[model samples]
Target: MSITLSHQDKITLHTAAHGAVSLMVAADATGRPHRAATDGSIALGSATGLVGHVLAEKIKDINLDGKSVAELADHVLPALTAAMSLLKQQAPAEAANFRSTVIVAIEAAARTHQAQPRPTVTDMIRKITAALDAA
Candidate 1:
């Protein structure tokens, strides 16, 4: 099915996707945040379909900047839920696609190191997943 998203909708999707990666990077306590960001971004770039198209754009309206993880989550978590809610309303398939894409990116970020994700990272992932599923 075809999906029509407004400018705000597009921004929300973009922010949610990238913000998820940023959260994962922040969750890293191993000083591999840069690598996590890079890997997560690569996964996002590999996304296909409408989610890919939306993410492939050059962002201008997104403001993922946050002095703390809490501040970032305040913006991104809701965006995740909103994006999912909107997609579910307009295109159920795209909703699932978006969820999968975000999950892959986060997992890619978490796997940046040889060891398993830290407990903090795991908690962050849980929070992100909850936000995604909150829709």
Candidate 2:
């Protein structure tokens, strides 16, 4: 059976990353509610935020093992160009956010599934992220 990420799952995952980033930014901006943890954990925001940070970090290794800039540029530019051309024809802000949310959800699901062998998610986010970056 094919595995998939649900909408709720995506929101939770993205919220983690987005929330952590926001908290870090907030802390830096406001400079309050800060405490040094005795335990070895980076204080960002909530568990979801932490998970996002960790996931983002883990993906760096995968990125290192994947395609080079030039190769990815060649592979992704055409599709991006075409897609952007289409997106530009219509208002794409909401659509873009939806796309991003879906992507993050897919990533979270993949991460969960990939923790075991016979990975069901199969690293969909990494591939998508790489392509998006290249594009």
Candidate 3:
């Protein structure tokens, strides 16, 4: 099925996808947050299908400039769930694409640690996964 999205919906998807990387960057404690963010963002940029088109847009509507993790989560986690809910309603296959896209991005972000991700990073990943599942 073909899915349509309003401008706000596009923004929400962008914010949710990129905001997730931002969250991972924030949670990185190994002092390589930039690398984590870069890797995660690269993963998002490589997304396929409709999710890719939406994510590839140059959107300035995203407002993830939160001062703290809690502040960021206030918008991101819900956006994650909302993105999933919307996609699941309009395009179930794309919903799965979106979920996998996000998970891959977060995993790319976490991989910056070389060994295992730190506890905080792992916890943040868990929260992200939970938010996705909450949809």
Best by TM-score: 3
Candidate 1 lDDT over residue span 1-135, tens digit each: 467788999999999999999999888746599999999999999999899998998879998999998999999999999999999999899999999999999999998767677888999999999999999
| 1 versus 3: better TM-score goes to | 3
Q: After superposition, how far is residue 32 of candidate 3 from its true place, in Å?
A: 0.5
Tell me the lDDT of model 2 at 67.
42
Model 2: residues >4 Å from true position, as ranges? 1-85, 114-123
Q: Can you tell me which runs of candidate 1 are displaced by over 4 Å?
A: none
TM-score of each: 0.96, 0.27, 0.97
Clashes of each: 0, 1, 0
Q: Alpha-carbon error at 7 in model 2, in Å? A: 24
Model 2 C-alpha lDDT per residue in residues 1-135, reported as the tens digit of each score: 222333433333333333322222222222222321111023222233223333344222111111443343343333333333333334344235433543444333332222341221233234444433342
Ranking of candidates on TM-score, top first? 3, 1, 2
lDDT of each: 0.92, 0.32, 0.93
Report the poorest 10 consecutive residues by lDDT, candidate 2: 32-41
Model 3, 1-135: lDDT tens per residue?
Answer: 568999999998998999999999999745599899999999999999999999999998898988888999999999999999999998999999999999999999999886888899999999999999998
The CA-based lDDT of model 1 is what? Answer: 0.92
All candidates: CA RMSD (Å): 1.0, 16.3, 0.9
The global Cα lDDT (0 to 1) of model 3 is: 0.93
* Worst 10 contiguous positions by lDDT, candidate 3: 27-36
